[model samples]
Target: MSALMLDPASGSSVGLLVAGLIVLVGAVVQGSIGYGLNLLAGPLLALIDPALVPVPVLMIACVQAALAVVREHKHTEWRGVGWAMVGRLPGNVLGVLAVASLPLAQFNIVIGVSVLVCVGLSMLSLKLSPTRPGLVVAGAASGAFGTASSIGGPPIALLYQHSTGPVVRATLGAYFLLASISSVVTLLIAGQVRVEHLSAAAVLLPFMLAGFAASGPLRKFLRGPRLRYAVLGVAAASAMFLILRNLF
Candidate 1:
C-alpha cells in the first residue's frame, strides 16, 4: 500500500472532532458489550477521514480491550485463550496475505457475508459452545478478519454469548488483546504503520476512554439474554453495513 492510502490526519478540525465522537460511542458500546468499537467506528471514520483507520482505530481499541481484561481478569478463560491463540497466529498470516493480494471490495464482501451466515445460524438456536475446536476456528476467523478488517470480535463473541456476561467480556477481551496487537505488528512490517496513525490515536484516546468510563452503568444493564441478543444484532448489523459499503 502507498503512504497515501491512509491520509495524514493532523491538526484540530471538525473532522477530527466528529471522528472522536464516533470513537466515543463505539468505545461505550464495546466497553459495555465486549465488541462493537471497530464495527461501529471503522465505516464512519472512513467516511470522515481515510487516515483514521486500520492503525489509529486499532490502537485505541487495544486500550479498550486492555481495560476489559483488567476489569474482568478473574473471569478470563485462559485455556480457551490459549486454544484460540493456536489458530489466531496462523490466521493473522492469512489476513496479511489477503490484504496483500485480495481486492478490497472482494475481501470485505466475503467477510460480511460469512459473518452474516454465522449470525443467522446462531439465531436459529444453533448452540455453539466455546469448545477447544470451536475456539480455535473462531480464533482463526477473528485473527483473519481482525487483521484484514478490524472486525474480529463477532466470531469469538458469538461463542461466548450463550455464557455469562463477565465471561463473555473477559474472554473476548483477552483474545482481542492479542489479535489487535498482532495486526498492528503485521501493518508495521508491511510498511503501513506511520506517525500519522499514532497522532490520530493520541487525539482519539481521551474520547474512547470517556466512553469506556460511561459504560459502567450500561454494562450493568446489559447481561444474560440482553447480552446474547446484542451479540447477534451487532454482528448482523455490522456485517450488513460492511457488505453494503463494498457493494455500492
Candidate 2:
C-alpha cells in the first residue's frame, strides 16, 4: 500500500487507476490477438509509475496466459510448446547475461533491428514451420529477446503467423504461461518479488480480466488472414517501439 503511494483513505492512487486502464487496453489487445500486452502497457505504465512495471505487470500477464490457456487449450501445439520451453531455458540465461554485461542502448538497437529484419525476412521465402527444430529455435529466440528486452512474443508469434487464430492464441498462451511462471520464479529467487508487487498485481487483476472478457467480441473480427496481419503489425510496431525507446 505505502509502496504504491496509495491514499490511506481511498485505498488507491491515481497513478494506479491510470495503470489499470492501460493494462485493460493492453489486455484486450493481447487477448484478441496472441500478444501485445507488454508492448502496449510497459511504456505507459512506466511513465505513470515505474513501480507498476516488471513485477506487477508480469503477474497479470501470467494470469492472463493462464486464462488464455484454459480458453483455447485444445488448439495448442503441445509438442512445439515442449521444445520451445527447452530452448527457452538456455535463451533465458543468455538474455540475463546480455542485460548484465552489454551496453543497454547498443544491445537494444541490435535486438530491435534484428526483430525488424526477421519481420522482413518472413515476407521472403524464410517462412518458419512448426517443426521441432523450428519451434526450439523460435522459442530460444523468444526467451532471449523477452528476457533481454521484456518483449518475447515476436519470435514465437512470427513462427505461428501462418497458423489459425485459435492455434496462435492458444499456443502462445501456453508458451507464455510457462515462460511467465519461470520469470516470476526467477525474480522471486533474486529477491525481486516483494509485497508491493503483489499489492499492485491484486489491484490490477480485475481490470486485466475485464479486458480479456471484452476481447471475446474482437476475436471474431480478427479471424483468418486478418489475424496474421495483426500479429505482424504488432510485431513490427513493437520492434520500432523498442528501437525508439532505447534511442532516446
Candidate 3:
C-alpha cells in the first residue's frame, strides 16, 4: 500500500462543530441500541465531504468498541467472536484492496449499494444467528464493509438480533469492537489514515462519549415496539439516502 495521505484540510471550526454534533447523536443511538453510529454518521457527514467522513466514523467505532467491550465483556460470546474475527480480518484486507483499485465514485457506489442491501435485509426480518457459517459470513461482510464504507454494523447486527437479548448485545458489541480495530489498522496499512482525520476524531471523542452517556435514561423511556420502530425508521431512511446519492 502507498503511504497514508490527507487532502488539504476541507473543514473549519464550524464544520467540525456540526460533524461533532452528529457524531454525538450517532453515539447515543449506538449506546442505547448497541449499533447505528455509522448508519447515522454516513448521511450526516456525507453532506460535508464523503472522503473525510468515513475516517471519523471509523475512529469513533474504535472508541465505541472499547466502551462496548468494557460494558459487555462479561457476557461476550468468545467462540463466536473469535470465529467472526477470523473472517473479518481477511475480509477487511480484501475490502481495502478493492478500495485501492476502485475510483472514488465507484468506491462510493459500492459502499452505498452494500449499505442499502444491509438495511433492506434488516427491514425484512432476516436476523442472522451466529452458527459456524453464519459467523463467518457476517464477519467477513461486516469487516469488508466497515472498512470500506463505515456501515459494518448491519450485517453483524442482523446476525446477533436472532440471539437472546444479552447474547445479542454482547456478540454484536464484541464483533464491532474487533472489527473496528481491524478497520483502523487496515486503513493505516492502506495509506488512508490521515492526521487531520485523527485530529478531528480525537476532538469529537468526548462528544461521542457524552452521547453514549446520554442514552442510559432514554432507553427506559423508549422500549419494545417504540424503540424497534424508531431504529428501523432510522435504518430505512439511511438506506434510502445512500441509494439516492449513488443513483444521483
- lDDT, candidate 1, equals 0.85
Which ranges of candidate 2 are over 4 A from the true structure?
A: 1-12
What is the C-alpha lDDT profile of model 1 across 27-71, one tens digit per residue? 989888888999989877877766666788889889999999999
Candidates in order: C-alpha RMSD to true structure: 2.1, 2.5, 3.7
Angstrom error at residue 159, model 2:
0.4
lDDT of each: 0.85, 0.80, 0.71
Q: Give candidate 1 regions above 4 Å deviation.
A: 1-9
C-alpha TM-scores of all predictions = 0.94, 0.90, 0.84
Collision pairs in model 3: 128-159
lDDT of 2 by residue, 89-165 (tens): 77877777776789866877787898899889887768766888888888788777776556777888888889988
For this target, which candidate reaches the highest lDDT against the unseen true structure? 1
lDDT of 3 by residue, 60-114 (tens): 7788867866876787888988888888998898778777786645665666666
Candidate 1's TM-score reads 0.94
